[model samples]
Target: MQSFRTELENPIVERDIIELEQKIRLFREGKIPDEKFRSLRLARGVYGQRQPGVQMVRIKLPYGKMTLAQWKRISDISDEFSTGNLHLTTRQDIQVHFVSLDRTPELWSQLEQDDITIREACGNTVRNITASDAAGIDPDEPFDVTPYADAAFRYFLRNPICQDMGRKFKMSFSSSDKDTAFAYMHDVGVIPKIQLIDGKEVRGFKVMIAGGLGAQPQLAKVAFEFLPADQLIPYIESVLRVFDRHGERSSRHKARMKFLVQKIGMEAFEELVKEEFTAVKNKVVPIDADAWIATEPSETPGALPAYTIENPQQFEQWKKTNVFEQKQAGFFGAYVRVLLGNISSDISRLLIEKLQPVIADDVRVTVNQGLLLKFIRGEHLAYVYSQLEAVGLAAPGFNSVADITACPGTDTCNLGISSSTGIAVALEQVIQEEYPGLIYNTDIKIKISGCMNSCGQHGMANIGFHGSSMKSKGKVLPALQVLLGGGTMGNGAGRVADKVLKVPSKRGPDVLRSVLNDYATNLQEGELFNDYYDRRGERYFYDLLKPLADLTTLQDEDFIDWGQANDFATAIGVGECAGVVIDLIATLLYEAEEKLLLATESITAGAYADAIYHAYSCFVQSAKALLLDDGVSCNTQISIINDFEKHFEETRRFPVSNFKDMVLEINKQEPSAAFAEQYFQQAKEFYKASQQYRANKTAQTVNA
Candidate 1:
């Protein structure tokens, strides 16, 4: 555990790395609780894998855009610190597994050298900000959304207001009305829009809020048909403020922003957001689109060496499915389908070495676990395809039905129940061999997750499966929970997949064959798969696939899971996807003190709004600690505030008078320097008093 302090240039990032090192030391020494350490490390992108004593380091790439150098840097880091493999995630980040926990700080320092980060890649914070991979190059886009997404990412990264929320927040930018980024499934999804204002064109966004995908998926409500671009960050900030204060806390399942909106109507949520507007740091933070430099090729294009095409038909197919003409004239965008989003470091290095001359410096990792190469010259497509083909990266059907999306599942994730990656590989083989023509079909999407948490985005897939299990005749077997009829409806609208049935994992390929065959047989002219499913109904698909679910037809092979050699058994570890519940009073008090320290730091930095929010968190944390000690369940921060008043303030057990109003003053007044100072003092006084009260009670008990 060597220090990374002197190796980093940026003081802030250096401090962050040093803090991680210190925390890791403390955690190993048993000074910090497991749950608290888990939350801290998760926020820094060090995730606990199913395998003991190793971590998965997720490198956050905002909007999935990375320079060739950054890509190479990650590959090198993978070779040095991980398994020499990189796993691209559905949120547009890259993950490397089997890393030693002690080496994380050094690994993170290396990543930051190229301006890459792992911060907020996991845990209860603002995760990666993803956008349409074709954001800048899409012809259908009203305007390029890359800059706006970048601005949002920068504004929220390490921002105090969202540092510790009830759950993670996701934001996306759809380049066009096609909704390629699936805006309807994000916490704050935006689609670029242009409006004529006073005879001039003005940039804006179609805003959608409170949407999420999991076991209980919800489509976002339209917050605004068109909100001016300048107001985007402020509006999002206000929403986060409201969510942090009033969102569910005790129950991890109900902690998302979508649940908050559901618990309180969207209209009321909007009112809460409005109440936070005054407290937000910026009322109208404008995004400077022109300041964002558009990506271009790093080298001059040289004449391609004459090469013979071994398979002209295959090359033609690749062109049709994987290549598209970009909005930039005479240039194109090509997608390289990375199977299961896993690429070896050797192949990655070769990709950079070979494609550097043919493509732009900007490489965008797609949401479907693939890579998007931008600004390819028309004459270079053949060479690019040849290079990709040489490296075994030339796969057709970039985002088509053949391109299946899946999580690591049992391979690494603690929550994985069955083998998602194995089943995905099997399903993809089935699609490529039997349904070759389906490669051109983009309407049908197939996704898989190890569990129903939707890490693989299975909740909104046209045809989806999540890992499960079934017991038959006293033996347990791996199973797949089938879901259908979910897909994007365009313009911040989508439908959640309906759980159809469950079948043995070995029959996963059969499930795909049956569904596609039925779809092909019963297809009407000019009908989408989902529309046809709706026309036929859920019961129709259930009955059609019902025969496969019959346990009596199962064999010994069905008892084993995919990509496994032995008998199947459920071996789920405690999931760290949302961190863990910390009910320990001492831990809560420590966090309160930490928040107060953060408040002082923010005040010194002249961030009054951030200071006020930190102070507010301190107040809530201290109150919740006392309430939990009194055997009160604090489900939400608002509940904690109200209950504290009921149990302590009214009873004169706590010194604070009108605890609710005292804390509620955060929203009632603007975040001025004076108000921020006053809030910090009040929070400091409350924490100290709470600490003294606890000390006295403990002394009395010990004496007795």
Candidate 2:
């Protein structure tokens, strides 16, 4: 077998991990080196990085729960292949890394053998479903959230409709009060909150819609009060159906569910979902969890014994910081801080190897993206903590502010928008040096997403940043969109940082400095950034730092250019069906949109084409319902070859139909006075209508 890289050079596994392992194999055989690997991948995917060697593979594990054997398999694989590091991502899956290109396919196959798959783990597809890892384990949970998560994953995975979404779709499942999972950052967040109805407790999820992170971030809107668990799958499918059918597909930047829900208004969107869910209601399946749970392997080698320790101070601190009483009495859950959640190559091996002998055979990862050693007797606490510390895994602050999480940004990701690891390191340093009390007094979490794709979940951070292109003078440059006021959409989830500023990649440190300084100076007592944004709208603080966003914003004293500058020149969007070589489409239908210019340009023609433009726009609006009725498949693209043809026959008066655009090479016989007069008339009328609409909207806003 060929060896992969020796930690000196590596590749990001964003788009997928297959090609990466192939390169590593060839290199180990001395057939290819650095340049070859770069050229091999430079084409098919987005490339970014952290430092240079330690690469991060952000795997998609939607709904967060996996089989016990799957967990053990990954744990063992991490030891044998990677640097023995496993990171539980906020999106509800674990990420392992440091395995060179050589071991990638092996790791993938190992996962595959267990009937687990990871396609689109890194790509633009809907990432892993995120559900509270403690769903079945937490007593406070309304029901086992795993089945709903599982059904959603199966129904949507690789569905055509979800393939080319305007942007990614995120969903979450939580049962407890620990919204620490950042469920609010998702496109859809589901939490079980018991409400009294007729003095009886019923299980239902408070459905949250629209909330997401990227250049623009917004808290989710509550869409439904109580959606029964049985209908959860259908309800979620309906939500995606609305998004898939109505979401904007043109601008890559504006393609998130949050944008769609915001533009249409929550009530209207909910009605649309109800209409769509009605279509798939019969296909829904109810999960019988007890039957499945009965199959779980019996607890390995009996239970761990409880021991009373002599050191009350240390025990008390550990109990306070490490343990929690589970829904099952005397069975407490605790998180083991792995210090930035990093593990060594050797430590990973021993962790899985010795776990059977230590705690009970069963172990589960937490939504906090950390390994959760559950069912540990009080006696095992000392031994586990000691061993974890021996490997530098004992970084204090189990939920303390210092337990900041960061995804691998440009440091090791090919598609990374920023240096996530680097920013995390710097941010932690500043926190430790500047404010020690905040770490203990309040729970502060700083999460960073390298790109808008949300590998790091920066959108839900107490403070967050999405990778962006900071262009000037018509060019591309590195920048980060600061997202704020996103957290768990449920009672347990905390609000993340709201976007207060968009700063250049290099200037992020300084910009954060300014924001922090302001936060410290102006914060209300006991107010976090989330509270500040809540009390005062996001704009109130962002407007304060307008100077940072202005073109005149100067670089800092430590400014230095890094990577290639963004291009601001002309651009083109390339896709299938270029010039339909039917000698190209018979004629161009340039999307048949109703831009203002089109309306004005049409009237210049002799009333014939002018009437057509108005008729076409009306036809489109009328047909909107039918167009979105069929429900596009979630994993593929929808090609409507005859949609335009049918529209053409019905709206025969229009100049263009059937996705066909028109170009008029008019040989004007003198500047026709008739056309000129009619053109101005239309423009004036359009202007008047636009002005009235704007005024009405402004008045409504002011009143609200």
Quick one: best TM-score, which candidate? 1
List ranges where model 1 is wrong by over 4 Å.
2-4, 297-299, 304-308
Question: What tens-digit string does per-residue lDDT give for candidate 1 at 1-704?
Answer: 45555477788888898899999999988999998999999999999999999999999999999999999999999999999999999999999999999999999999999999999899999999999999889999999999999999999999988888889999999999999899899999999999999999999999999999988899999999999999999999999989888988888999999999998899899999999887889889887798879886545666766766667888999999999998888889999999999999999999898888888989999999999998888878888888888888888888999999999999999999999999999999998889999889999999999999999989999999999999999989999999999999998889999999999999999999999999889989999999999999999999999999999988999998988999999999998877767799999999999999999999999999989999999998998888888899988888999999999999988788978999999888988999999999999999999999888888898999
* Location of the lowest summed lDDT over 10 successive residues in candidate 2: 577-586
Q: Write the per-residue lDDT of candidate 2 for residues 459-567, one digit (tens) a residue.
A: 6666676666666654455666877666554453445455577876666665566666777788898786667667767777687666667656544321322332543
Give the lDDT of residue 133 in candidate 2.
Answer: 59
Q: Clashes in model 1: which pairs?
A: none
Model 2 backbone overlap count: 54
Model 2 misses residue 562 by how many Å? 11
Report per-prediction Cα RMSD to one decimal: 1.2, 16.0
